[model samples]
Target: MLSDPKSRFKPTSTAVADKSNILSALKQPYSNAARIAGTMRNAYLTNGSVSKVIDYYQSHPTYNYNIYPVLGNKQYELNDNVRNSYIDIAYYLRDLNIKFFAPIFFKETLIDGVTFWYKYQDKDGVGYMKLPMEWCLIRGTENGVYRYMFDITKLNDETVQSMPEEFQNAYKEYQSNNTSDTNTWYNNKYYYVQENGMAFTFDYNSLVNGGLAISPFASALTDIISLAKAKDNVNIKDNLDATRILQQKLPMDKKDGEMLISAKEAMIYDQTIRGRLPEGVILATTPTELENIPLTNSGTANAFDTVNKGLEQVFFSMGGSSPLFGGSTTSSNIVKEGIKKDANWIYANLFPMLENYYNSEIATVKTKDKLLWNIKFIRQSNFTLHDDIMNLKDQLTLGGSRTDYLAANGFIPAEIISKLTFEQQALDIDSLMVVKPTSNTLSAKDAEIQKRGRPKTDNPSDDTDRLDDEQG
Candidate 1:
């Protein structure tokens, strides 16, 4: 009655067509979507305000991260083997140089809504190479898993040869198939294999749309265009304002509009005026009047202001505060809080996504032994150190461990323990500290020595003895 239950799991015709079109579109030499991606990248490169917004995203305060084992959500001390394994992972991560790539990733993701990197191996070990967003496409998802494709035709021969053998073979087979069928050449002639580690994507816009990644700047594209036009207009107005015009007059005769001067004389006068004037000066003559005018405030008096407002609007549309690009004195507090919120949201979402992708796709690619570990990237800049200290203090007040306080405040617990042991045993630093008794302890011990209640000792010898005893 259900008519083959497995048939329901198959991809629909529309989904298949979409996937095919996505591949074909990206593979084409001049796809509009790819061009738009290129344009966004170029804007970030060329436009100062756009660059500032993107740099803000990239320049968020960075934090150190460590990988910890997830041992069933129970409280247990990490054994030496596990701790050493985590340390090894830390060293591997440092060698991987992910910190160097992270800013690039942030910039590209802000522009393209997605970033791609190719994973490869050589004598030095596993490495990642960033691939152009315009050359990459998603082939759709299978069972909630995404599969990616890259336009091999866009890549050079050396890069293609450097890929994994599986990917290389697939590319060669596609080339052979296409060469055999010259009449039916396809736009999606490039090749890719499924589930290969050759390429992976950082989809910042994952699941919001289908497989395709829509740029974050997509919605603000119209504002960006408008802002560009506004800037051009401003430039034109500024040029006009920098220009000057001159007017000259000659004495007129009273005989009923008789020419004050002959045409030849007028031409001579014009030449004289033009030759006398410097650059950016224009002149005109009339018999009745003479005036000189500079082209200041031409076209519109408020054109510069208009440009400024447009810039602010563009920054706002790009999900950035006006102060980030320039000055916004009136809304400084609001913008500061807004930026803080944006930082929190981005750190919460973006960092975790990157961490997870690195852990699953990169850190574990070389070996399976790291499957149990995850690199926890806590953003240190999300909160100020003072705020963190206060929170830790509150936590300590509520019966949290002092070791937690030390660890969370960027101190290594084991290193602190070892340092303290050495300081006590070798340096004898503890003996230098004079431990002062608390009020309650001192009161309980020296109750009889209250100066108001106790009389002074009259005997000089006894007084000297008491002083010696008190000093000791």
Candidate 2:
């Protein structure tokens, strides 16, 4: 019998006490970082035109200023995490960064083991959950210490029932447990945990106004939005310019006026006769009277070019290059070099942060001992096979050793190259010997006679005649 697909992955919930009042008491400044990040994401996905992007930003300026950290966090998430972890920390960081700009990771000791949880705000009004970095907040900072906050309303009856008996018992004890301070419940309010050095707070050097990190793109995006609106205005103006109305001055006579009106109506209806206008209506007019209205300006083409340039600048400000997002593929070497420089700048800023996070949080004792935490950003190679081969040849010709060339191209280890070189030397030595021809080998004359049956007679025609006589 076949099983139901829905039954295989069941939804579970947990019951937990409400902590809204307690959470509200420790409220941090509200930042619309998530909204800005979401807008950027949408713009990139839809390839939003200047007008659309500007309109969105203008209507939500406060929201727009909060997106930089979110964007930076996402970049970190993408470049960090080369190895797949059990929890996929990169994925969680990406989600949090997109939604909250300020992503936080902290460890929690559960009944089963020590697990990490991402801070996210819960949709359910009851309270937050000990979930992945889905929805949560930085409640507030007291002195130099920061208290990470989350609500337990996300824990439902179904979730508890699914837990192992030991875990369930541990969870119950955890809920009932009280903090050292008598004023707060252990599970109901924000508590200060020692920073394990693994927690990340991606602010991107943003100005802390009212406890919210202001986005770096905020000022630059204003100009981009304006440009977008201007481009739209130019398009609208161009469309208006394309529209031409033909005006003809008719004679004051009622009959001629009537004929002109009829002709105009015919043209309007797209039903004008192929070769003739209405009778008495003349097609001929003075150059001054029948001139086309010029709608396009001399600089109309340049206006569009300017808009394109503005768009490229916007992309650059957002930590991207023109070539990255379907810009010119066959750019000049200087342009390509500029793109590499930009990429390196991003790497320089992002890689260190990722490395620190990995070293503090993700790196286990065993992994550290094995030196597995040394992170490297995956760079896209630009060299083709032919280019690589030419480079290798040039290097080798410049007196570089075979081992160095092979290792540089990642073809083989130095030890293997040495072994192969030794084997090749042996083969060359063996091939140096040459054997003399044996007596059994036929001479050129003997080989030709064998091929042609017998040697031809000096008088070949007479031989042919003799053969013919014998046959006869």
Candidate 3:
């Protein structure tokens, strides 16, 4: 009975089922099982589930608009918790880069191995400015080949008009080609110019996204920032709801009674006396009474603390210590150490990447025979002045020359050190020089006598001599 295709299998005293029959039912040539399996396989192969998810994320209209305006354009803005994180990181990175590797123009010949360094300057005397790495958008494939780079340039009407004709034309052409696109460079929008006028669209040997470079925080930042914003919204709504609850009045007494005043009269009474009640005014009320509302004291158990934890997570994800975003004036030793660790990590990883990108751009402008010099980024140490001073003292004590020690400690510029040495020598000579009083030098008494014409008398008294000196 079980083997029969028309029979439905059921547990009974006489019922029996075998593996062979079950297998036959499942694998039958014309059975519905094969059709169901084939359908699932086709769906998997076609990525039907994945496509639906992606479509929901990409095609949804609500996701396309910015929810917050104060933070800037929603597409480019981060959540409040991590909103300023990128800006802070970018600022530090840009400052460090500028401090260490403000571009220097150099020419090198391959044959003689001779190199000449020149201060970087534009022919127009506007000064050669290196674009900050933080302001650039790097996009590339998975193979470390940079495909497209965008330099974020803020141009106003006057500045745009003042730009060179070649740059203006190129910018206008770009705008004309991309007018329909939201990312176009019209008006105050960002403009993308070719690096050093090179036609090559891709940069080679870039570690992130083929050749396009990006902030270290770019990958994990968006989700964390969004989560933080969501938390803040939830917190605000919760607090508002709690406040509303607190504002509601509770019934103190229950009595079925008709009001002495009509609805219109009550409205008039409220409008007149709601916020303008005079002191000591009393109204007789026996049947109807209203109770004062009490505030609700719902404990905010760890809600804000959770938000803080999320912020810490964001900072950590961005290669920063939690204390950096803790908004505290002071931190513990552990936090300081964590910050130092993060700094070292950035120096080792981020600075080198940026340096390499700049070097690649620099190479493009160099002639074939001119050896390209890679710019070096100096990572500023967190050592305090005390540390440097102590180190300087130690070096001096260890027989290091004063000039070398001072130079190594960066106490004075090399050019000014010579002048300082000359001044020190002059001061030493002045200190060493001393004139001995000669026997012919006039005494105070003799000088007074000479000034007062040898006093009034030959036997001048002590008081008379002093008075004469004073008079003289």
Candidate 4:
């Protein structure tokens, strides 16, 4: 809302928790990553700005008419751009470092969609959903495309047991699980058999109109993220009140319930804890004493204010000496095409806040919450945004325009291209053991089990199907 142009103040907070992100969930069952990837891809293809190859087919009249026979979805025939839409999403995600899984959808909590299939003999419909002769993408990149095979068979001995229940059911209903036909090939190690190697082919799109293709979408990402979080709250809210939500969900074995410092959250928390520190930690405390500057021991407001005043003068001196905002901020500018209000606000608000932040951060390096947590927080910059929302100011606007001084790092999603003056480089496994253990030795096991991989079963073919789908 801060970026609404009409909105007057900036947003600020250190409330971020990495409840769900790309790598963490994907490390579970391949299905989890695949499902999330599908959502991301679906959003990418369905988005209006992606300039993928699909747009070509979708734009054409003749090619648009050639689909009903292949997939049976009337929408495919009318949509024309089906293939392009799928792959373009793949391309866009590749840039964000998204990993892809295909063909077999392993069952796990990592994904957000359901398992759907047809062709079943069930009076109760539950087992029917597991049958695969008739299959639905249920989730992943396809927008509404479901594929079904009729009169499926089954394979024999080892192969039958090797398949995921979902895939095996589909195979049995299609052709009685019979892969005696040489068409059987190794997807990874498991045997995914079709009378003729007619496996499903999935693709990735790395770039779109030339920006990051986020799954939840940057604009409405909170909604998707909220759904993901609501799932987490389901497990967490039962024990604690609203105030202790973060603490209860985190690793409290330390000084009680505490999360590993979020470098970002720590930045702001340090500011708060700094007030509780002693006088020596403030005027007399040296960087060497930072370790001793925790909320366990803090200074008074008078001491904190004293330090803030001195620190502010120094930061401003440096900012004043560095440079001014005189460069062109239009699209024609190589680095920054157009300057944004938020970007400009950064120079005015956040930068100034940094002066105070530096002192606050340094003073409470050893403090609780923000200091020891590593949660990066922007102290009150130009605006007094509350302590509930995250806010980042645009510092670099290259190919775009430096002129767009955004108050919030809203463009973090846009993957604003830049010549990073520096080259670079999640979750605490300690806190996430639900069905598993939570103590020391158990925590170790939890680490291994939850270690984050493309959850594959005893069967390796899930890996192989992935390879085939990617290669195809």
Candidate 5:
């Protein structure tokens, strides 16, 4: 899951805090089976079966889409009860003999490395992990096949104790009843994974790509709670430490000098001026052209440097320089504006019931798998206010200092180009409901580690030829 503390895609500070809080809160034992059944009963009964349960989810604010049925990836609030309810339903599915994911589930056991769970309802509709939000967004697999098949690995907890004996025996009984070799990701750990039937080779890095930002705010909140109660192992400190950095690669050149007249003319000729250079054409004279330099490695999944810069402009255009940092008066003002804007959104207005739904509906008053639960919900939506806050946080802090987007001049590959449509298309409801961990009331060690400064780099390599190669 993206919630893994060791996630390669380290979430922003807010996300980190949110995840940590959820984990802290969920540390106690929970009744997974019972909780799921309660949600299923309500989701199915009040909403009328699985289909309507999905409908109920779509209509909520946190889940609402500027474009209905097309849910944006982001977080929705979940109290302890809400998460427990979700677990109950998934476990119910496992018990019903309607075997769709057992193969993936069982195979992951061999590796014990998979952080696996299945989401029945997505912001858009069903099967977000496998399905694309839109028909056109489908890649790597065929379209419309997301409902039935799955690409999954098992999750083993080594830091935590292993499953109890009774649970293991029950699982064995189920496996014995269903005996078949299906190709799966863990079939060999080398390639194919097999369990009940389904199988496939595993590509760990690509599969566990970007999705949603989990909240570390809850972690901070928990630290406050733990501190009042006295804690030692947990840390709620927040800063740039703990090594959860989000590095994006973008196509940009250092802005040491003017853009090449040839490249600038290329853009101008492409549309604006639509003609050849008169005759005095000196490539260095063009002001808009960008040099071919690696601006930054993309951090925002499909975003390239040029596109990221454009996004940077739009975000800053929202009266911000980068993502928000809520300590100073300046940060407070921006946070207020961002929060207001997020709350007053068109989509946010339409489906204002999302938070309550998670609280009152999805998360059924239990903390079972709370961390995983939050990560799953956040990952399911894209059009969310959470993105808005995240974008703000990016601008105000380290994001403001990042040099990734400075040198880009608009060249983007076809694949990443599609995702760029997020610019002003519509507000993703998920962003508004999703909150990053920003509570300062906690005294957590993780937060303290984050507050620590860099130990300093002592690189001895000198690049005296930098000026000559800069082409300034």
Candidate 6:
């Protein structure tokens, strides 16, 4: 009998408390940093244009990595623990929620300028949870030395209970020490100080505004507000246009060059228009005629176009191109080339930081396992695969070392050569292969000419007939 499908893997639990509510309730009046980070996070979650740019990076290929042995002039025996740790790291990353974390990572690093991950050990070795931006407070002077303040109240009672004994005891102590003044108590006790390595923080850019990174979307917020207002105006106009108004012209008397109508008669007409007309109707008595008027004209028809233009500005502000949205955009090639440039930038700037982080974290794990050889990480991704392949081709053509190129392509040249040699000898396949004529090997025509002794005169054209005669 087959086992239950749920038994195949470990179950994951989510936090029960509403973090937004906690932030709203516990937020200090002096700081808008949490609110600003919340806004940026919410914009990424709710806005299509913003999400699209982040999604492009989030959906980018997971890194391909190699663990290289780094032994510096020291005689060390490579043990099974050292070798297996590499496999353990690979599996841990594979099982981790990288797809979910990647978008948050990109959003924080690129826009918010900092990101935090709560690292913990589990049955799967190590796991990371992306901490809420609003609940996180950056403290300390230097960027490297800065510690993160994570609000413990953001986690519900169930989550707190599920935590380890140390965190549980802290939470209980906080609960016992709670006071009437929520602000002071919350500010001082609710926030748990996460030490440097315990909580992973990537502070890629310079900090500002009370150690809070300014959002890239801050400039585009005005444009977004304008777009919203414009959309509202357009909707209002459309609603007005949807209802047709009736125009009634009562008979008027021209007395002393002045058009006049009885007030009673006008009141009666108004009453009739209001009662009998379907909706959106008005009555007026005048010497001239009256006609139903439309709310807009060709002059004001560009309202929607203006909205589109504003949207384009917002897209650019969000570090995205119009072509990324992919609807009748003429710049597919532009965005494609831009993607290449982005990949290059990521490799140059962002990847080094990630490499350092992983190397340090995994080294700690390996040390616990009594591993001797220190492992170095080499990260690659499919984003630059085409360029890498082209460069490799060019280099090989220019007489680059095959061993180096093969290693780059993730091959062992010695193993490959050994396998080829085995096939050549054991299978004897080389004996059956036909050799093609090269400059060193004489061709059939040249051999025949050489055998017949080069033409005495300028009778090279007759060599074919002579060869045929010689064959006969």
Best by TM-score: 1
Model 2 per-residue lDDT tens digits across residues 255-328: 54344345555454443332345443334321234665455562366667777787777766554455644567
Looking at model 5, which ten-residue stretch has the lowest summed lDDT?
130-139
Indicate the TM-score of model 2: 0.38
- Can you give the lDDT of residue 213 in candidate 5? 12
Q: Model 6 has how many clashing residue pairs? A: 0
TM-score of each: 0.64, 0.38, 0.39, 0.18, 0.18, 0.58
The Cα error of candidate 5 at residue 282, in Å, is 81
lDDT agreement with native, every candidate: 0.58, 0.37, 0.36, 0.29, 0.28, 0.52
What tens-digit string does per-residue lDDT give for candidate 6 at 1-472?
1223433212121221233433442344125444444555565665666667766665454443334455545636566665455455545544444444544555566544455555666565444555445555555432234445555666567666544454566576677765334433346554545432222334433234443444445555555556655666677667666666565665555565443667687777778667776555444544466655665442346678877887788777665667657634665688777667666656665555555555554454444345533222223346556566567567888895554444446433233344666779887877777664443455556655555433323345643443444645
- TM-score quality measure for candidate 6: 0.58
Alpha-carbon error at 8 in model 5, in Å?
27
Residues 299-393, candidate 5, lDDT per residue (tens digit)?
33333333334433433332332343212344555655654454344233222222222222223324353433211122112324455435634
List the lowest-lDDT window of 10 residues for candidate 4: 60-69
Quick one: how many clashes does candidate 1 have? Answer: 0
**Winner by lDDT:** 1
Cα lDDT tens digits, model 1, 116-200, are 5555654464555555555566655443334566665654456555455755765676666653333322345634434433222
Q: How far is candidate 3 from the true structure (C-alpha RMSD, Å)?
A: 25.4
Model 4 per-residue lDDT tens digits across residues 222-256 = 23344344444443433222221111122223555
* Tens-digit lDDT string for candidate 3 (1-472): 0132322211111211232333343343223222222222232234322223222212211100001112323335334544233223223233233323321211001100111111233433222332223223334322222323333243334444544444566456555564334444433434434333211111222333332222222222233434445476657657644552112122233454556456676566555554454443333223344554433434345566666666555555445555544445464876667645644653554345445544454444433223323334333334333453466568687784464344334422222334465657757755565543332443556645455434445565766743454654
- In angstroms, give how far residue 394 of model 3 lies from its true place: 7.9
Q: What is the lDDT of residue 438 in candidate 6?
A: 42
Candidate 4, superposed: residue stretches over 4 Å from native:
1-116, 122-127, 130-145, 148-472
